[model samples]
Target: MSGLSREKLLGMYQKMVEIRLFEEKVFELYGQNMVPGTIHLYAGEEAVAVGVCSALRKDDYITSTHRGHGHCIAKGADLNRTMAEILGKKDGYCKGKGGSMHIADFNIGMLGATAVVGAGLPIAVGAGLSAKLRKTDQIAVCFFGEGASNQGTFHESLNMSSAWKLPVIFICENNLYAMGTRQSRIMNVENVADRGTGYGIPGVVADGNDVLSVFRVTDEAVGKARNGEGPSLIECKTYRRRGHSRADPAKYRPKQEVEDWLLRDPIKRFKEHLIQEGTLKEAELLATEKETALRIEDAVKFAMESPYPTPEEALEDVYG
Candidate 1:
C-alpha cells in the first residue's frame, strides 16, 4: 500500500527484529541443553517472511520449510506455542508431535512445515486444488529452500499446479546454498524464478534483503492469485547468517561469502529503512526489543513447565 507508511514500516521492522532475537535466544538455549533435536535458525533472511506474509490474508494457507519458525511467526502463529513446539512440550501446536520441523497452527493457516526438502510444494498445491474445487479464492504459499529446487517433488508439483491452474504461490527462498552446497554450483539456470515460466506460470524475482521490494512484488502476485489468476513463483534471493541446521557448521561455504551476506542482514536493512522513513523512534524501538525479549523469556518458561506427551498417544495420528 503506497510503499508502506511510517507505522507500517515500523511494524515490519519490529517483526524482523523479533525473529532475529528469537533465533539468537534459541541458539543459546540449545547450547545450554534446554531444547531438543536439530534446529534450523532463520536469523538473516527475515525480510522475505515478513514481507510476503504482510501481503497475505489471515485465511491464506502457507507451508513452511525446516527453517520455518520465522515464517510461522510472520503468519501470526503464537510465539509461546511455537517455542513450546520447538521444545517438544505437549502444550505445543501439535502437542509435541511435530517438533520444530512440524510445528503448525491451523487456525493461523500455517499448514505445518515439512522436514523433507521440497515436499511441502505438493502439499501446498493440493491445498490449492481444494480451494479451487471449493471455489474459494484463498491462495496457498510454499516456502522451500534452493536445495529443494532439484528434487522430483518440485518438478511434479509445479507441473500439476500448472495443469490445474491452482491458486498457489511457490516461494523459493534461494539463500545461495542447500545446507552447505553452493546454489551456483548446483543450479546452472540463470534464475530459479525462471522455472515457473517452463511450467507456464508467472515468475518474479525480488531483492530478498529489501522488505519493501519483496512486499511490493508479493502483493502483486498474491493479489493476482486472489482474483482467480493462476499461480506465480517468487524467488527471494536471500542468505542465512548461521549454520543451515544445528548439526551443520557450514564449513563448505567460502568465508568471504559469509562475510558478504552478513553485511546484507535483512533485519538491519529493514531497521535502517524504518529509521530513514521516520517510522520507528529510537525509544520506541528499544521498548519493542524489550517486549520481544520478555515474550521469548516467558515462552521458554511456559514450554519448560508444560507436560510431555504420553507414550500411548504416539500411534494416534497414523493409519494402517
Candidate 2:
C-alpha cells in the first residue's frame, strides 16, 4: 500500500468486504430456495478480483469464469442489478437471462461471465483485438481458474494475443481444484504462470490472498499492456472457501488443507493489515462492514421485489 492513497486502500478493503458478504448472502439465499439454478461462490478469492480490477480503468474490459461474482463486483457492477441477475429478475444485468454465471454490464466494460470453462479467454482476446484495432488504450482482463489453463483456448488465445501484441491480461486463479479435481491430478506444471513463457509473454505469480501483492503485480501488467507491451499471464495462487458449486460439499479435500487455507482468508488478512498499518481503525472497519451489510440487504430486497421475465421474453434476446 506504499504507493497507494488512503482512499484507494480503503476502497479495496470495502470491495473485498462487499464480495465476501455478497457471496455469503447468496449462499444463504440458495439454501433457503430463493435463488434458481446453481452458484459458484467467490467467498475466498476476493483479493484476486479486487486487486486486478482496481488496477483497471472504468473503460477497460474483463471476462469472467463461473465463479465470477467477485469479478463483476470488483468491476463496479451495481449490487442491486447483480443481485437481480442472480435472482433471475427482469431488473438484472442480462435482463434476468444470464443468472449467476452470465451477468454482463457492457457500460462498465464487464464483457460477461460464462459457465463454460476456458471460454472467456478467447472472448477477452477478441476484446483486446478490438481495442487494438480501434487504436484505444483500453485493455481486457481474463479471469479463469487454473483448470481452464489446460484448455486449448488458453494456449490459442495467449499465442494470438502475444503474436499481435494485444492488450490483454490473462489471470489464472489457481484454486488447485477444477470442480473437485485437484490440480496435481491434471497438469504437470507447478504454476500456470509458467506457461506464459512458452507463449512468449511474461509469467508472474503472486500471493492471491494478499491484496497489496496482487494489486502491485496487476498494476505493472496493466501499465505494460497500455504501453503496447502486450499481454501478461498472472497466476494467483488462491483457495475457494466453498465447494465447486452449490451442490458440492467439497469433501474431496482433506480437512487439514481446508483449515490451512481458511487461516489465510483474504478478507481477514487485509482487515488486519489495514488495522496494523494504522490506515484504518477497528471502529472504521466495523462501520464499513455494517454499511456494506445494509447495502447488501437493500440489494436483496430489490431482487426479491423485482419481477421475473415472462415466458415470451426468453426468445427476445435470442439470435441465430
Candidate 3:
C-alpha cells in the first residue's frame, strides 16, 4: 500500500473494476444462453486474484482454478480473446477448444488453468522445480479453493514443494464455502494459513476483502521466493458473490454472510480510496465503466463473426 506508486495502485483498482464488470457480463450472457458452457464467477473475490497477480512479474507463473476469468484478466490476458474462448469461437485464445475454465495464454506465463479440482497443485510444484533446476528466480503460484486443500494432491504438492524448497506459492482462496459445504463443516482450523507452518514454510492470512492487504502480503512472499526462500501458503479470507458455478444458486450460503461481505466490497473500497486521494474523479470512473462496456460489446461481435476452427486443426496443439 505504502510502497506502490500512485499509477501502479490506480492500475490495480482499474483491473479489479474490469474483473467485476467482465464477470457480470459473462453471467448476463450465460443467463441469455449466449455462452457455450458453464462459468464460475469471481465477482466478490476480485481482490484476492488482482492483489496477488499485481505482485508478480510477467515471467512468473500462476495456475488457475475453474473460476479463472478474473485471474486471466488480472494477469493481462486480452479480453477479446478470453470472451471469444468462453463463447467457443475460432478467435479464442485456444481457438475455441478451451472454454471458461481452461482458457490460458502461456505466453504470459499462465501455464494454463485446470478445470479439475486440486489438479493445479502438482503442476505448480513442477513449474517451481523447473525454475529451480534452470537456476532462475521465477516462482509458480497455485490458486485453489478450500475444498481443494483437503485433497490428497494438495497435501502431496505442498509437502514436495517444501521438501525440495521449490519456488512456489500456495494461495487458498478460502471463500468460507466449498461449492455448497460450509468451511466450518469441512475445515477444522479456522485459519488455513496456519497449515503452512507444518510444512516448514511461512503461513499468513490477508484481508481478502482489501486489495491493499493482499498486495502487501503477496509482495513479501514473492520477494522471499525471488530470494530462494521457498514456497509459502497464503489463505485469502473472502467470499464469492455468485454461486459455486453457473448452475449453482448458492442456496447453502447464509444470507447474512453474503450481505456482510458485500458491505465491504473491494470495488467500493478502492473507489473510496481513489476518491479520497483525488486521483479518480467521478467522471473518470464513469467513463472507465463506459469504455469497458464498449470493449466487451466489441469482443462479443468479434467472437460471433469469427469462424469455427476447421476439423484439421483439431489434431493441432494436442501436445504440451
| Highest TM-score model number | 2
Residue 171 of candidate 1: its Cα lDDT?
Answer: 89
Model 2: per-residue Cα lDDT over 35-85, one tens digit each: 889999999999999999999999999999999899999999999999999
User: Residue-wise lDDT of candidate 1 within 1-320, one digit each (tens)?
Assistant: 34567677777777888788888888888998777888999988898999999888899999999899999999998888888888888888988889889888889899988888888999999999999999999999999987898999998988898888898998889888887778888889857899888899888899998888889989998888888888889999998888888778889878998898888888777666566667676778878888888988898888889998899888877679
Q: What tens digits encode model 3's per-residue C-alpha lDDT throughout 1-320?
A: 36678778778877898898888888888988978878899998999989999999999999999889888889888988988899888899999989898888998888777789999999999999999999999999989998898899888998999999899999999998888889889888998888887788788999898898898899998988989888999989998887899899888877897888899998888788778877668778777777878887887778778887788888998986
lDDT of 3: 0.88
TM-score, model 2 to reference: 0.99
Model 1 local distance difference test score:
0.87
Q: Give candidate 3 misplaced runs (Cα > 4 Å).
A: none
Cα-based lDDT for every prediction? 0.87, 0.95, 0.88
Q: Candidate 2 — which residues are off by over 4 angstroms?
A: none
What's each prediction's TM-score?
0.96, 0.99, 0.96
- Higher-scoring candidate on lDDT, 1 or 3: 3
C-alpha RMSD of candidate 2: 0.7
Screening candidate 1 with a backbone cut-off below 3 angstroms (N, C-alpha, C), the clashing residue pairs are none
RMSD of model 3 against the true structure = 1.6
Q: Which candidate ranks first by lDDT, i.e. highest?
A: 2
